[model samples]
Target: MKRILVVGVTGSGKSTLARALSNRLGLTYHEMDALYFDGPGWSVNSELVDDVSRLTAGSGWIIDSLGSPEVRDLLWDRADTVIWLDYPKRVVMPRVLRRSVRRTVTREVLFGGNRETWTGWLSREHPAWWSWSQHGTRRREVAHRTRDPRFAPLDTLRFGHPRDTEAWLSSL
Candidate 1:
């Protein structure tokens, strides 16, 4: 599990797990969002491909999020293992809602120094609604993608519940 990819819908704990796994395994942790969003604005990072390419050239790394399709193609082919946080919407929505509220209320700056606004939730672009709207479709898409023959060489560890992920982390 040297080169690991942690993937999930927003707020599904991919970043948390990726950080933990990187710490436990002593691998370089690369938060993809940091590479995808790098300033005080919403523009996509143009250096994303170069950043990912540089990381993949190394022998070990653990990254969070399935990046843009271009990056995903490059990442998935090189990653040795993929940890999928497949928690259900029932379990995920509240967590996302709480996180969204906390980040908004606290004005926590995220990737690109972006802060969530309560009024922002009125749109589907908000993390809460994005997670809510994308959860099912994201689940199906990732599941099907991983099943392809091209990805057969990649190891997959999927967690449907928090406890399952906790146990796996503990085991590691």
Candidate 2:
């Protein structure tokens, strides 16, 4: 509950949980999307590593994104607990699809001045695509990491359903 790393497939409620965790624990909230995506005409910054390093260097904070292994390791190495939102694909897919549609239709500004577009939603590079493709693999990856001796010392909280996740967070 001190310093947490909230990981999940897109639309699995990572941001929401991170926000609530921040408020409940009185910690800082760091949205990784904002750090990774640059303003207007969305582009990945070369300085993303430096920014992520700076953000995770603090003592008390919650990160809502899972970056590269090197960057993620840096955060997890320092974090006291790791919360993985492992909701079922059927539960997550619809949420992601609806969210994508809403963002595309409304042209909502996110992560700087960047907005999600309908074309991007159709593209394989979109978060929705990543979510769909990585659903099973990501869970295996997290499971392996949790089982590895290197990560064994890290506290792990995994939720197979959103309601269970809510209950766990409520108890925190």
Candidate 3:
């Protein structure tokens, strides 16, 4: 699988799976979060278009984040594979919460030099909130997009739950 794009609702383990795939396949791992969120004030990836171009210009690479809808064609047109980690809320919510708590407790530095905080976790903008609110919509959107005639040439792999991800990854 070359030129892969990993997509899912926020905190659905897209980045994690993409990273593993990159390592296993020996492809360049592009953390779109690092590109989009790597700003001075948590900006919305001001350089998204240019950065995406630069990253995808190569023949092989794995992108962990979906970036923006504005660049969907840029990615889908070039990507040979698109992996969707569409886990259910029951499985994803606790994972997101645990990840949030771990990041907050660790004071981990994320993209844009941002650190997870209790306040941020409680805020509406948090990834957890986004995951909860967008779970169903995101699943439907991904399914529809994958089924679209425009993307018919792309190979889509969807994992409905965490076990599916592990099984697939392990097999690889």
Candidate 4:
């Protein structure tokens, strides 16, 4: 299970699971957001592809994203295993809401040193909003990607509920 990709829609706990798996498996953990966002104001990393390519070239890694569009295909091509958190909106909405609220309330710093703000919630890009709006689309995308012939060499584990994922993690 080396070179793993933890994939899910916004607020689906991709980072948390990927980090835990990395720790358990003693693999290098790479937070995709950290790699894509470079500084304050959510500045983007212009060299994202180069950075991701370099890291994926390594023998072992667990990245907590499907990858942004620019590097998505590269990630899927290199990954030996993919863990898909395919939880429905009912499960993810509350998780995302709570997470966004807590982060906004605490002014917690995130990737690129950006913090979620009350006003940010109004934006479509906000995690809460994104999770709600893109829930179905993201699910379909993941489903299609998993079935794609180009990625047939990859082993996939798809979990439909938090409990199932938790049980599997514990078993691991």
Q: Best candidate per TM-score, number?
A: 4
TM-score of every prediction relative to native = 0.95, 0.92, 0.93, 0.98
Ranking by TM-score: 4, 1, 3, 2
- On a 0 to 100 scale, what is the lDDT of residue 95 in model 1? 88
* lDDT, candidate 3, 1-172, per-residue tens: 7899999888888888888998899999988878777665587777788889988999999997554786778888788899988788888899898998899999998888888888887778798898898888888888888888887688989888889899999999
Q: The CA-based lDDT of model 2 is what?
A: 0.82
Candidate 4 TM-score, C-alpha based: 0.98
- State how far residue 21 of model 2 sits from its true place (Å): 0.5
Inter-residue clash pairs, candidate 4? none
lDDT of each: 0.87, 0.82, 0.85, 0.94
Tens digits of per-residue lDDT for model 2, 55-93: 778878998855566477777677778899988889999
The regions of model 1 sitting more than 4 angstroms off are none
Candidate 1 residue-wise lDDT, 1-172, digit = tens: 8999999999899888988988899999999888888877566888889989998889999999776787987888898898999999888888888998999899999889888887788987788888988988888888987897887788999999999999989997
- Measured with C-alpha atoms, the lDDT of residue 146 in candidate 1 is 87
* lDDT for 9 (candidate 2): 84
